[model samples]
Target: MQPQLLTVPAQSGPTEAVPAVRPVRFAGLRLVHAALRRDLARLPNALRLLQPGDEPGAEALRRHWDFLTAMLTCHHEQEDRRLWPLLRRFAPELRLLVNWLEDDHHNLDHSFTRTTTLMRIATRDPASAWSVAYAVEDLAARLETHLRIEEEQVLPVMTSLFAPQSRVGTLGELLDLLRLADGPGAPDALAWLLEGVAPEQIEALIAECDDLTARQWPHWQAVYARCSAELWGPAATVE
Candidate 1:
């Protein structure tokens, strides 16, 4: 699916269409914040499974590890391609933060790889799981801190620095970049956003995404449906 470039709305005209929800640009960042929160909340459960002599817990840890690997890797990749470059251009004073984020991405990737490798070994050789679990705990701690910093500092900067129209454009670029990197999960991430957002906010997101290719819409819709079912069950209705 090709990502459509966002159209710049008139800056000063009162006659311009008032967006139905929060602009996609800000909505996207809020989505990321929610995801980070969700993942962090799951860390303790993951860590408990890693305790020594807990075979069942070890298996549980492995499951969480796989989920985190997929989610965090996708998140970091999207930021590297879409958010960082634009931040560099629009907020050069934030260069340090961007660089640190990039470094953290590498750190996270390394930790995930290491933890995955250990998980495979531990699955086959139970004694090995404890060692891997300790490493994962460390990684989770770092990740939690990183998430807090990004949410508290980075997101606010993004909200304040970018114009509404430019923010929407950047969001389109970010989504497109993620689609290239993670395929359907890019939209899955979008669906994840819907959980934390108000209905009105989602309407705005859908409008912004409408700027993209028609093909992308199906992918995003599928993601929303899947996540809604998984997160909220069959009874959940998506606006």
Candidate 2:
């Protein structure tokens, strides 16, 4: 099952009971998860397109895979360094859950390494395509479980901690902390995250951007769109 990315508030309870934890908006995390799901869903097909004699398709798929790896690694590193520590402080009771998520990160890293290695092999020997496909499938399965649990356990806590009234910090500050990257290929990565997002969600994200970023956002979108068309030619929809 897909993890519900939206933060859901806890319901009302009795007088002596702990107050219901209200859900906080996490536009950034939700956006990231959506991109992860959509792009990952396409990896197997992308790999299949790279038969032994197809150098052009293989190169394109490799570029796509490289970008995906960067985005995923950047995301996990941000959370490990910033998000998780902040969350652990507020939800000390969730220590076990936090530990599991960290472990999942390690596991997923290993999965990415294996998948990348197989993909590299498949590039030279098309006979290795099946092996690459299996690796991709295995990675996807592991990610599915990790994302589900992360959405269920970790995201809610992040929302609660970042809730405006909670005084932990503003969503804008949280956005800064969770930024995926700012160097080369950053726009494509950002555009990738924004893919298939609802208009309202886009509006919400843009509203949080600084003036310079807001102005430059469209440029990034166009750049990534062009790159996407080139990478997934004639595929009508990349998502």
Which number leads on lDDT? Answer: 2
- Supply candidate 1's per-residue lDDT for 238: 52
Pairs that collide in candidate 2 are none
Pairs of residues clashing in candidate 1: none
Local accuracy of candidate 2 as per-residue lDDT tens digits, 69-153: 8667767776777677876787898888887788888888888987888878887777777668777877777788888887787
Q: Give the TM-score of candidate 2.
A: 0.78
Residue by residue across 158-230, what tens digits does model 1's lDDT show?
Answer: 8788776675334455466567774435555566445544555455556656455434755665656654443
| Model 1 global lDDT (CA atoms, 0 to 1) | 0.61
After superposing candidate 1, which stretches have Cα over 4 Å from the reference?
A: 1-25, 43-67, 121-138, 168-171, 182-187, 196-200, 211-239
